[model samples]
Target: MKLQTLRLSLALGLASALLAFPTAAHAQPAEDHAPTLAALKALQANAGPGAGVHAGDGSTSWTLSTGTGTVNQNRPIQPDERFRAGSQTKTFVAVAVLKLVEQGAFSLDEPIGGLLPGVVTGNGYDDTAITVRHLLQHTSGIPTNGLPLPQAGPDGTYTLAALVKDGLRFAPAAAPGAAFHYSNTNYEILGLLIEKVTGLPVYEAVTTGVIGPLGLTRTSFPAAGDRAVPEPAVHGYRGARIGGFYFWLDGTVYEPSNFYASGAVISTLKDLTAFYRALIGGEVLTPASLAELERTVQPGAPGVEYGLGITAYALSCGGKAWGHNGAVPGYFTQTLVTKDGRHASVVTNAHLVTNVPSAQMMKVLDTALCESRG
Candidate 1:
């Protein structure tokens, strides 16, 4: 069977199994169940237009759109809207590296220096000591370039090497397996290493090896200054409070090159779901590599857990899921899938904020996805 057909068959089989066995009679109250499509739509409406939800089990899916505005002040968000997957792009990079490992091109424990000479950050720590495993697990002790949000300008055209060098300025905070300090620099370095080893640009390597195999035509690593927003993309926003006054700011179109492999891919809900289904279904990496990818290295804070390049969580409703969440300057997004890849993909676009609402919305969406397994 073709790969896509095989994946759908596996998903259907799993869904059939899950449906065949009903949950315990007294597990939880029906009133406290996950949100329905209507409920999710109402919640997004409350949050504001441009806010939306996409949920689907292997058998069926739904996209709930609410709010209004051109995704780029020019186009409307529709059923097929695409958006930057943001840090969720890390999962793609991680899978790519793992595939290379499976092919005998590299090893997880191999030092990164040999792969990309003159690219490893040179500081007190031995550059040769950091392994590909450390990069995937976010335990390399690499500090980010301190520039959390990139300002658009000529300066925005900085290269991946510049970003890695900026991160190297700071000494490693802890020993290689110590703890997790999320840093874009890790994946940026990984991207460079992929390019060095494959003799292809990061984008080309990922597209040929992963995206094409998964049939995800809607996803791509766009170039810098590409203002052509994907069709039906949602507009992202930012909110803040200053001197007791609350305000919302419009987010600019994300420059994919600015983030590179760390967080730059643009994809729609359908394509994103397709990619994860293929990944967890064992189409991208070897069985051993997939096991490594799903192994948790460090515990993410409340409501999340960190694996090699993914996040796992036990929903409040019940059951476990794997996937990642992402945020850029003007947008925030969450993607989740069941351990068996049978659950839905939950994505929401919100005005960025450091507040409780975003967190609450995530919880709602997660619970909804988990409980909707039936």
Candidate 2:
């Protein structure tokens, strides 16, 4: 089936699920404790028809998407909807690498050259200068070299190695460990390294070690040939200014293999939240490794720190939240988890538009959800 048709089908499914909820149910007191569900529903309601929210703590999880059959031209958004996670894939790769570290595959300080020879593109520093830690922490100073690949057509799959080769034109920005420059190439190489060390594909390693163990069945590494579509997947749209008129481009599906380890995973909010909780709660990595992941570097951004694959943001709520914010061509997603693993994750398919209703919806949901924690 065409990608757009698939998206329409998923959206319709979500809308149907949402409309199944009775609107005439007993009106609970607004002041009642545990307002996460109600707050999420309110956010969905405000987003108009075809909007949904899935929220939970350590105990229970709930999903709610509201609307009638195939609302909004058969493109209703769903709760378990899968979207391009973008840079959030970095965390998954980092976790996989950390698992290898814990299994005595390599030390954090071990040089990347020893793991994957000739993967580094430029040469201000030798392979000896770059370590596994350097790549994970974004201190490798590798220049970001992401090239937009055209979507799959009648041609076959494009391998990750081809994507890396396409990115090799750029030189390193600084000496390894000298500064923090966000580079998709860093994780791309890390993905290659994971494949090298494990003797399995990067996708296999992540699925077997991280996603499978955490029970995140909603998540997977999508590739060109794979027909395994995530249920309730949202169709991503991009609004572009062409000749002073704004036009929306529909049915733009990103090639996950092009993103590779940098931005390939597709997941639901519930699954993403569960993964964050697992990682932050020390269930995924050792306490020492987790500490290393949380350690701040002096690359010089106020309240911004790099820990392995995660980004640490000091929240106004007097705690540190770690995760990544991601923007693909047609999606924007943010996943934030406290040091203790409590978190708020939001994902939207509306992209490159001036007025983003998703952002407003997220803000409302976050304020209400966080206030409930108080």
Top TM-score prediction, candidate number: 1
Q: RMSD, model 2, all Cα superposed?
A: 6.8
Residues 129-175, candidate 2: write the lDDT tens digits: 88989988888877777545443346655666666666656677888
Native-to-model Cα distance after best TM-score fit, residue 293 in candidate 2, in Å:
2.0
Per the 3 Å backbone cut-off, how many clashing residue pairs does candidate 2 have?
A: 0
Error of 1 at 192 (Å): 0.5
Colliding residue pairs in candidate 1: 49-67, 81-232, 237-351
Q: Lowest summed-lDDT stretch of 10 residues in model 2?
A: 18-27
Query: 1-374, model 1: which lDDT tens digit per residue?
Result: 23354345445554332111111111112343335544555444434234445566767665554444332232224435777778889999998898899889999998887777677756876668888999998888886556543444574665666667766777887777787888888998998888888998888888887788888888887655564456666655444333423234444475576677888887776777777777777777888999999888645577567878898877777767777877665555667777555544444454433442455556646755765676
Query: After superposition on all CA atoms, what RMSD does each candidate show versus the true structure?
Result: 12.6, 6.8
